[model samples]
Structures are given as structure tokens and as C-alpha cells.
Target: MNCLRSILAAGLASLVLFPAPVRAQKTGEAPGVQGSKNIRSMKEIRDEGVVKQRWDVSCGAAALSTLLTYDFKDDTPETSIVVWLLHRVDAKRVRSRGGFSLLDLKHFSEARGYHAEAFSGMSIEDLALEKTSVIVPIREKGFDHFVVVKGFVAGHVILGDPGFGNVTMRVDRFQTLWKDGIVFVVHPPDDRMIGEKRLPVAARLVPDESLISRKIGVTAPSNYLY
Candidate 1:
């Protein structure tokens, strides 16, 4: 009995002297599992202009509305865009086309008095030079969808997704999902220019244009001219 008691005492002393190391919990990790430190959160893409798509097939219209409302301060309604495009083509044809096309967005933007242009083979680095937010089509779940590229935050692409609200994606992931590296760039309407130049929505979110530029290895434009 004394020997058994001695063994127990020694074991308790050893435990007190050398407690097992406790693993530190990582940020964004589940209870005991180590999780990705790169976990991202959805932040408001714009202070006053994120427009969610009211219908499953209206992502293009909603994305256009978001860009016009936020970047150009146009306050265009998604329904107006939808109505305008539907009048140009049959509703059944739009449904058959899978959704509103980038061409439709271009036409609507022009109708609203914004200068819209489409470019292919534009890299994310190219996007860093843009002075305004752009609309990009990406393949999501085997379907083509439109999302507004607000700007780069750190190494992630900030997006104003009409269907999913504001979101961000890693650059590599965005590249993988981006369709043909196509970008739709829009300039503010000529008639309603703001007297004072304002920062782009992404710049407002990060507030450090130099930092974003440095992080992305490209110089961003000084201001998103209205």
C-alpha cells in the first residue's frame, strides 16, 4: 500500500512540475481545431449604395444599380433597369439567355448617361488602375453571374454582389472564378459631375490609398472622378 501511495505521489508531483502544453486557440478557429487565419468577413461594400437583387435573374440589373447608385451617385433603381431591358427584349428571351447579359448592362448604363466600356484580358492588376468601380462577370456554381468589383482590400477583391450583398474574395479565388477575365468599366455621367472629387467606395472603406496600392503593387488613381 505504501509503494502504491508513493507512486501516486510521484506522478502528481511530475504532473505539477511538467504540465502538458496547452495549444493556443487561433483566431476564427472552431473550439479545438486550428482554422484558416485567412477567413474573411462580409463588410458593407458601400456606405449608402448596396442594392440587393430582388429576383434570382436580376443580378445584372442589381449590379448595375449598385454601381450607378454608389459610384456615380445616380440612385438608379434595379426595377428601372429591369423594366428598361425587358422592354428591349422579350422576358422569355431574357430567361432563355440565362440572365441579363453584359451587353444589356452596357446599354442600360449608356441610357442612364454613363460611359460604359467592356474589356477582356484585363488582370486584377489592371483593375488597380481604374478610378471607378467595375462590373465583372464570374462563374458561380456553374452559372454566370454579375458582381461589382468595389476594389482591392489587402490581397482580397472587395465586391458589391447584387445577389449576395457585399463580400470579399481572395485574389487567387477571384481569378479562378472570373469569366474570361472580362471587366465592364463605367465612367460617371457627363452632365451630373460632382464639384468635389470623392474617393472610391473601397478607398473609403480602407482609407489608405497608399496602403492598398502598396499591397497590390500598383498605384491607384488619386480620385474616382465623378
Candidate 2:
């Protein structure tokens, strides 16, 4: 009965995360054409030793820790960070059911050098968070899960899934999984951590270069593979 209840709880979480499938956007262009230009790929950063969640129901904390350590390197154990985040969220069910309330997440992230928000829809520019990570809710393995989106490539959003190390999915397919379009985005701080530097590569801005009136610059993650 305990096992059954756990399974049922997870099932409910899945429905809440991805309520329904969304129709794919009809774009006449090829997938390659839809890929963003001049953005750092998640592969690059994941290779640089991002922290993984150490607990089963600590996906929310793990994803947040990854973003917190993305620009700044901290030797703190991920478990410790998870506890800190849970306290900030101030929810009792998070430890057992494994999720953060949108209000709690927004308040916690915003207080810690991030501009966090809950959004139903966003533009490509919005997804293009240079130094930040977007927490996306998805359904998998009969449960709802959180994945941190670190970068974009070939029209696909690269995710640092708490359950799966790293994965990529078509934007259209991603939207289907992101049912209800609820997303928590963490924007980077104005002053990046020490040793963070932008690459010299000039990227063609998405939505066209005319909007920005200048070529956008991208950064290359440090190449220290773990």
C-alpha cells in the first residue's frame, strides 16, 4: 500500500507538470534554420563539472545548486545547498513530494542574485540566458521532474535533467512536455563571478540583428572536462 501510494503521488505530479500535449508549431523552415546562432551549448558547460543532485527527491535543490554554482565555483556539498534551498522555500511537502511552490522559488531565487519568475510563455531571447539557467518542468518515468536548461543548440533546448545527466529535445516536443507552460527562469547577476569571461565570437542575434543594432557576443565555458 505504501508503494502504491508513492506511485499514485508521482502520477499526480506528472499530471500537474504536463497537463496535456500541445500541437507542434508549423514552421516551414528546417530544424537547422530554427537553431539559435552563437550560443554556448550545454554540452560545453556540463563537461565542466556541474553538480548533480545527490538525493532522489532533491531535484529542485540540485537544479538550483547548479545555477548557483554555474558562474561561481563553490566547494560546498550539494546536499548542504539542497537543505538551504528547502528552508528558503519554506514548504513541508517538498522533502517528501519533491517540488517547490512557484511563489517560494521566485522569492528565494530573486533574493540570491537572480531574477526568477513563473511564466507560461517566453520568447527565444528569454530562453537565451547567457549565465543563468531555466528550470523547466517535464513529465518522465510516470512522474514530474525538473531540468535546468543551460543552453540552446540546433533549435533544441539543452537540459541538465536532475534524473538524467544531460538531454536535448526539439523545441516543439519540449513545449508538449512543458504543459501549462509553467517555467521558473533564473537570470544571471549583473557582475559575473571571478574568471568568467565572454568569448570574442560574434553571434547573429535571434529575431534579427536589426533589433539590437549590434552583433551579440557569446561566451565559451571553461574546457575542464570532469
Candidate 3:
């Protein structure tokens, strides 16, 4: 009995001396220790512009809306943008849920006078000191989701994840999940013109989710002077 008691006491002492490390939360503000003190976030998106992808898998649209509104100062509804993009891709309906592909995003942005380029061969080192934000599709739970890569913090990459707000993860892990290392960097026109075109009649339809659920119906599609 005394030997057993001694073993139990030692085990308890060891536990007290060497507690297990606390794992970081998977969402929201990153743990202070893991990220750098100098952090940069798109304040407009966090404010009135953050596009939430409620029911429709319009993460691409939401991400694009975020960039347009925050970076380009165009506050267009996300659902309308989704519809517009679907028409551009000839997808027919917003219910397709992420029906818009990365290629589609590039074409649509270019049509609107934005400079969008796709990068398949890029390393985290390549993103170092890159001031512009990028959109990358990450595969999570057997599906690909779109997210805006804000910048690098410490060794982790800061992401404007539509589903979870801001999140930070190590570059290796991000690269592992990022589909094909595919990244689309949307750059505003050199002339500083935002969405230099009017929204087509087809893009005017409100996505079912937006109108019925959010009750935020738009009168007409946004007119970005393309």
C-alpha cells in the first residue's frame, strides 16, 4: 500500500510540475503570443462591410465583396455580386453555392478594370512583405472554401476567413490546405477607377438566401463603371 501511495504522489507532483501545453483556439483573434504585435486588419470589413456567407456557399462572392468594399471603397451587396458573377460564368443561379470558380473571379475582376492575376507557384516566402491581399481557396472538410489572405504575422498567415473572421495559421499548414497553391491577387486599376462598369440586367436578381433570410434586398445591381 505504501509503494502504491508513493507512485500516485509522484505522478501528481509531475503533473503539477509539467502541465500539458494549452492549445490555441482555432478561430477569432489569434493568441497574442503566436502573432506579432504589429498587426494590420481591414477595418472597413470588420465594420459595415464584412460579407457573411450565410446559407449559400458564396464565399467567393463574400470575399470579393470584402475586397471591393474595403479596398475599392465600393459598398455593394454581396448577393448581388454573387448573381453578377454567376451570370459572368453562365452558372444561371446563385443556389449553385460557390459555383463561381477562381478563373471566373479573375475574369470578372478584369472585366471591371481590376488587375487580377493567378499564381500557382508561390511560396510563403514570396508573400513576405506583400502589401496587397490575396484570395486563396482552402480545402476544409472535403470542400474548398475561399478566404482572403491578409498578410503574414510572425510565422503564421493572417486570413480574412469569411466563415470565421480573422484567423492565423502556420504557413506550412496553410499551404497544405490551400488548393494547388492557387492565389488570385485583385489589384485596383492603376487609374484608381473602381468597378468601371454598370451591372448587367441579369446580375440584378437577389439571391434567394439574401432576400428571404437577411431581408436585405437590393433595388438594382451595383454599377461599377467598367
Best by lDDT: 1
lDDT of 3: 0.52
lDDT of 3 by residue, 1-226 (tens): 0000001222322221112232333444556645424332223223233456653356677778777766577676678776677566555433333345666667777777788887776677766644566777666434566777766644566666565444456677788877676677777776454433221111111011111111211121111111
Q: Where does candidate 1 have its weakest 10-residue lDDT segment? A: 1-10
Higher-lDDT candidate of 2 and 3: 3
Model 3 Cα displacement at 26 (Å)?
A: 31
Q: Which candidate is the best by TM-score?
A: 1
TM-scores, one per candidate: 0.65, 0.54, 0.58
> Please, what are the lDDT tens digits per residue for candidate 1 over residues 67-108?
787677778899999999989967876665556777777888
Worst lDDT run of 10 residues, candidate 2, spans: 1-10
Residue-pair clashes per candidate, as listed? 0, 1, 7
Model 3, backbone clash pairs (residues 3+ apart or across chains), number = 7
Can you tell me which runs of candidate 2 are displaced by over 4 Å?
1-49, 72-77, 85-92, 110-113, 123-125, 129-131, 140-142, 193-226
Ranking by TM-score: 1, 3, 2
